[model samples]
Target: EFNEVFFDGAVAAEVVGGEGDGWSVAMGLLALERGVSTLVQQIGFAAELERVVGAYVAAGSGDPVLRERLVRQWAELRTMRWNALRTLGTTGDPGAPSVAKLLWGGWHRRLGELAVEVRGAAATAGPGHWAHGTPYELGLDEEQRLFLFTRADTIYGGSDEIQRNIIAERVLGLPKESR
Candidate 1:
């Protein structure tokens, strides 16, 4: 039933030429979850990585400008997977910060890359263009709604800026700057 609905919806969007946006991202996440689960069950961790990387590439291919952004998104997910594995490997016991450091470091670097992508896209596409609809013509209520919802991506795993700070301080050993 779920697969039926999912496919039907995707077909409808294709027929209508829907402006790929949040809905596409949601579908990608769902596919990633399912792929990861199947790979974990059948082939284990290494296979799971392969599955995720493939999924990431496919997702990124959706938009040329968004490709690098999606790659960074994939990297963030991979880092999360690494952190989860490390925690499990430690048997829930604390040890050297090396594992956490590596995870955070990777996350930070990816966040920086994503930031650049976002800024570049924004410069070319302009604000509110990242989602849907034109920036100048959004109605008041629509504008407010989009403003709130568009933030969902940045906040979801972690804000890109926060991730950047982690990379700079812990990974790069740079002095902290006040926000």
Candidate 2:
């Protein structure tokens, strides 16, 4: 049986900034324990994952195998997450309001794509990805939690570039740019 765990801001912060394998594993387990119904609540969790990856990259740990695995895992997870958000978008149930529907329709897609980009960047940057110091310094648990968490932001709903184009064309009604 699965239970839902509501993450307060502090817990969220801890999850995002945790460190090492132990913290990473614990965060994953916590997420899993929350079951599939909590996808909406878990958006922050996904963002945390992105931050964690940034931290790992910054730490100067030259583990190519680990990095590769992280990239693959993140991609797969992001796809699943995007699908979930997209599913939420199509449903107009009162429980799923229009604002959330609209947000999922585009914003979430962009985030998913961003996750993919970060993953690729992490791989390309390798150990040097975060060599210049990370934007924030989360604890080890939060760091690990975030690293593995953000894998799905890029590929599932839409990519960052795609989302930007969408906003330009649809919301702003700007003319399409030529490739």
Candidate 3:
């Protein structure tokens, strides 16, 4: 189900907020959604950070690079939480949601990468045995799953580029990019 499409264009329905206003409605909702969801997401991120730290500790490998990365990740997590709290309940800024999205999207993806890296080479391999007649079986462990799934973190809700554009144009008063 890695490439599973949750929903396609099969179910057509009338727009609730009115025709031609879908973008506006969606943006308004997204602004509010981003504010609230980020706080919840920080909890999950904190747990994941602990898991990564546990892996690092259990390994007993003092690779300075990873140690520094882990510390940086912790700092970034704190920054993300503060950013979310700072922007919460504020509707005056148009790019606040995009800012939040941009902050956590990259951070989560990096955490996924860190999760796999903390496990070293062993994290790359899956179950060695095949099932039935199939030569391949999908048996990704937690770290592997996290690494693979977070690849789309920046692309799903709004891509990093899109978020940057939003911040540039809406927040910074920059000119919009040409279509």
Candidate 4:
């Protein structure tokens, strides 16, 4: 694969990126599920984060309190990703993948919010209100319910279109694209 050749074939996990369907921690989840190592390096800002800290400390530009706050946020986000990896490799409620999905699922429904969160940039939304609902309310049959509860095979939490959009935009990072 191009990525393997580009990275010298050391990649054990791949963080899929796009403007939608961006299950941010999915690669880690995949790594865990496939028994691959997630610490193979260069997973997006993962490699950059420490350098960012170093640069900030060296430059000494930002306020100490502000830096501390940003660090805390980064810690929270990192922990969330870690939890996802942990869940996929575990069993039942002990896995706690649903908790991660519950939190991340909301982001898929609100791309504008994610744009703001990730890039501090404003983004517009289509004409639909998004809110989490139970599978029963969504008219999901047993199969869908089983899929939803298990967090298996996918990392989305809505209609097929919404799910596909999340897969397209976030996971694939395709901007303003269709199908």
Best by lDDT: 3
Tens digits of per-residue lDDT for model 4, 1-179: 01222435543445245334345456345435332232232153344444445544655556665476457645755765676566545543322433444444432233222222332211122223323553325553332333244342233333345455545565566795544
Q: Candidate 1 has which clashing residue pairs, if any?
A: none
Tens digit per residue, CA lDDT, model 3, 121-173: 99988787664547754677878888998899999888999999989898899
TM-score, cand. 3 vs. native? 0.86
Candidate 4 or 1, higher TM-score: 4
Q: How high is the CA lDDT of each candidate model? A: 0.44, 0.47, 0.89, 0.42
Better of 2 and 3 by TM-score: 3
Off by over 4 Å in 2: 1-39, 89-179
For model 2, how does the per-residue alpha-carbon lDDT over 68-139 read when each residue is reduced to its tens digit?
A: 755764675576566556544342322222222233434434444444444445433334244347744332
Clashes of each: 0, 26, 0, 17
Off by over 4 Å in 4: 1-44, 91-179
Better of 1 and 3 by TM-score: 3
Better of 3 and 4 by lDDT: 3
TM-score versus the correct structure, for each prediction: 0.26, 0.30, 0.86, 0.31
Off by over 4 Å in 3: 1-19, 130-137
Q: How far does residue 15 in candidate 1 sit from its true spot (Å)?
A: 69
> What's the TM for model 1?
0.26
Q: List the candidate numbers ranked by lDDT, top first.
A: 3, 2, 1, 4
Pairwise TM-score winner, candidates 2 and 4:
4
